[model samples]
Target: MTPELLLLSADRVGVLVFALSGGIAAVRNDMDLFGVIVLAFLPAVGGGTLRDLILDAPVFWLEDTVSLWLALLGGLLAFFFTRFLEDFKPLRWADAVGLALFAVTGAAKAWGMGHGFIIIAIMGVMTASAGGLIRDVVANRDPLLLKEDIYATAALAGAAVYAGLVYAGLDERIAFGLGMLAAFILRALAIVFKLSLPRARP
Candidate 1:
């Protein structure tokens, strides 16, 4: 596949997964359908929207309605099927997948658009994470940004790997795959091992 199509596919997968996680978080917060859907959309699209706006690219969701509908479906599924998922032990693992995919996709897109490595890395973190931050605030929980959650760090570490590989002239797919794997593995470890960054003093 062409790099553009590859990046688009990766971004779509990340968005869908993040939307599902957002919907799950909404259910956990006792939000209704509307709330869940909103949360899902915000998490799924917010990062890319922000990135596109900053880069003067067409806002992605405005150009494609599929992402919107998918987010809606994810939210609805979470709302209706939360009980089925409540007892599942792999929820954290699923979230890690979303995080890793989003980070790699964001970095790949930025690099494809001719952004510098630093900007690409920042965009990677943003694409992977800004949605969940919005969800937490909207749900009246302390945002992960305010806590020692393994959230942004997971994205940053993944982004660094992506940037480094790109700088090293690796094949695009190999780089992207490795970057995504790194992020996912780190995030899963963080969840399973209770890994977290140390808190800062005010």
Candidate 2:
């Protein structure tokens, strides 16, 4: 894919999953439609918004309305099909996908802007986790992003992989995909087996 298309694809997917996660959180909290929409919008764009502000770049959703629409779609899906989504218990998995995609995309964005590897990784983590932080805070729940679930570790691993691969002369598309996959797998395993970096407390 073209560079622009790749970035768009990753960003849009990230936003959707994050929105789904937020929607599920709202549903679990017994929130109404308005609250569900509000929750959906938070994690869907919070990380990117923070990234842009820190980078002094144009905020993404302001640059494109499709993201807002996608978030709305996610909210509507969760609202109308709460039972179906709940059957899958998608909050953790949605967050996992969102985290991975955002991390890779954020790393790519920073790299495109001439940042060094460290900043790219940090930006990736910020973009991956900021929205989740907002989601947990607004829902009055323990911030999973701050917990020992290997959440940020997975994001950091993805960003690092993307940055390393690009620097190693791999195609950006391949790098992006592999990076996202690495994160998703790590987080998914953690979710399934109660794993954590530095090892989980027994």
Which number leads on TM-score? Answer: 1
Candidate 1, residues 155-184, lDDT tens digits: the string is 988988988998899998899889988898
lDDT of 1: 0.82
Least accurate 10 contiguous residues by lDDT in model 2: 86-95
Per-residue lDDT over 47-154 for candidate 2, one digit per residue giving the tens place of the 0 to 100 score: 889999988899988978999999999888888887787777755676687789888888999999999999999999988888889999999999867876788888
Per-candidate Cα lDDT values, in order, are 0.82, 0.87
- How far does residue 77 in candidate 1 sit from its true spot (Å)? 1.5
TM-score of 2: 0.85
Q: For each candidate, what TM-score against the reference?
A: 0.87, 0.85
- Which pairs, if any, clash in model 1? none
Residue 137's C-alpha lDDT in candidate 2? 99
- In Å, residue 9's CA in model 1 sits off its true spot by 7.6
For candidate 1, the clash count comes to 0
